[model samples]
Target: MKLKDLAHSRTGDKGDIINISVIAYNEKDYPTLEKLVTVEAVKKFLGETVQGEVIRYEVPNLGAMNFVMQKALRGGVTRSLRLDKHGKSLSSILLEMPLEINN
Candidate 1:
């Protein structure tokens, strides 16, 4: 399975920083996400696009995690020539992360 099977995501950007919020469909899945989703994992997944650091904040009460990625926008929307300068597409791409389904 993939993370998308358990959660949905929203993305926003400020300057060269990108913020992606991954919200689990149920509270029960929050723990799994907390364990499997790490700042290192996200940074690795994003690869060279993320030139700075990745910070993850857990919101257990909300059953969600927010990832703040710095220097990820290829220099902010106004300066970038990339079609998806805001990095909105990154949320969906992040969702593609594979996960083990332990039933």
Candidate 2:
């Protein structure tokens, strides 16, 4: 399965940092996401796009996880030559992450 099957994501940018929030559709799915989605996993998924540390904050009550990626914007939106400087599409890209679904 893909992460998108269980959750939706939103993204934001600040300077060279990127913030992505994954919110589970159902509360029951939150635990699964919490276990499967780690900072290292996300960092690896983003690859060279992310040049710095990846920090994850769990919001158990909200059934969400927020990932703060440092140095991820290629030096901020204003300076970045990349077409998607804001990295809004990154949220969708993250949804493509493969998952092992256990029914």
Candidate 3:
């Protein structure tokens, strides 16, 4: 299954940083989402596009996880040569990550 199967994403980017929030559709899914979405996992999933560190902040009360990805925007929307300079597509890209949760 994919992360999108359990949650949704909201994103923001500035300079070379990207911030993402993954919120569970059902509160019960938060535990699994938290376990599957880790700093190392996100770093690997996002690959070289994110040149700096990835930090995960848990929002258990809200059933959400927020990620601060450094060096992700390639110098932000104003300077990036990439099509999705603002890194808005990152939200959807992250949602595509495969999750190993059990049925």
Candidate 4:
């Protein structure tokens, strides 16, 4: 379902980009997770509350999904030092996403 339920997240904000990697415990569910963790879907979840360009990468080996959010940090490093805090919340937020599988 949610990213937190499925895996752990590591987030980094550098310059204007926010990078998040979600690692799943059960690697077998990667395919299904990938389907639900699409760039567009993540973008929708983040919404206008934040601004960024989202890119998703599949790491089947690690059973992880990496999301690169561009320009998410509005004020850059100096103005907003909230990257770590935001990252923590993002991990949990991602975990809450529901997964769908087609048989």
Candidate 5:
């Protein structure tokens, strides 16, 4: 399955940072989300796109987690040549991450 099967995403950006939120469709799925979406996992999943560290902030009350990736935007909107200047499309890209969720 894909992360998108159990959750949805939102994104924001500032300078070379990318902030992504992965929110579970149901609170019950938060554990599965936590298991599959680690900081290392995100770094590996994103590859070289993220040049700096990725931090995961748990929002259990909201059944969500926020991933703040440093140096992921390549240079921010005013600097990068990338198509998605604000890196908004990255949420969709992250939702495509492969997963192995068992019900």
Candidate 6:
């Protein structure tokens, strides 16, 4: 599924929270994310890169998952002075992630 679809799946408009959806193209990619991007890993990634609490959830319908991050933008605005807080770049980072799954 596309990121737009994923974002739409997240039904929240608090502005403080940002949710991203991701889907793996194959089985190999699936396992990589499971092994690499754990809850703590996601938290650390978002915490350092963003200014909020990151929460990730698995969704079977889309063969993907959702990441609901809080306070990602500094000053609670899309354009934060913080150099590291650009949510648009998250798509690139997530694309690099491979999802890990086990039989």
What lDDT tens digits, residue by residue, belong to model 1 across residues 14-90? 99999999999998999999988888888888889889989999999999999998999889988987899999999
Residue-level lDDT of model 5, residues 41-93, one tens digit each, is 88898898789999999999999999999988788778988888888998998
lDDT of each: 0.91, 0.93, 0.92, 0.72, 0.91, 0.54
RMSD of model 1 against the true structure: 1.1
What lDDT score goes with residue 49 in model 3? Answer: 90
**Per-residue lDDT of candidate 3, residues 1-103 (tens digit):** 9999999998998788989999999999999998889999999999999999899999999999999999898887789989999889899999999998767
Which candidate ranks first by lDDT, i.e. highest? Answer: 2
Looking at model 4, which ten-residue stretch has the lowest summed lDDT? 83-92
Best prediction by TM-score = 2
Ranking of all candidate structures by their TM-score, best first: 2, 3, 5, 1, 4, 6
Cα deviation of 13 in candidate 6 (Å)?
A: 8.0
Q: Candidate 6, overall lDDT?
A: 0.54
What's the C-alpha lDDT at position 42 in model 2?
88
lDDT of 4 by residue, 1-101 (tens): 45666677777777767788878778876777777778987888777635866888887888888898876766555566675534546666656666654
Higher-scoring candidate on lDDT, 3 or 6: 3
How close is each model in CA RMSD to the real structure?
1.1, 0.9, 1.0, 2.5, 1.1, 6.1
TM-score, per-candidate, Cα-based: 0.94, 0.96, 0.95, 0.79, 0.95, 0.58
The residue ranges of model 1 lying beyond 4 angstroms of the native Cα positions read 101-103
lDDT at 62, model 4: 87
Off by over 4 Å in 2: none
lDDT of 5: 0.91
**Residue lDDT tens for model 6, 1-103:** 2223222222332454556665655544554444455666566544465566677787655556777777765654455675544455665555443333344
Better of 1 and 3 by TM-score: 3
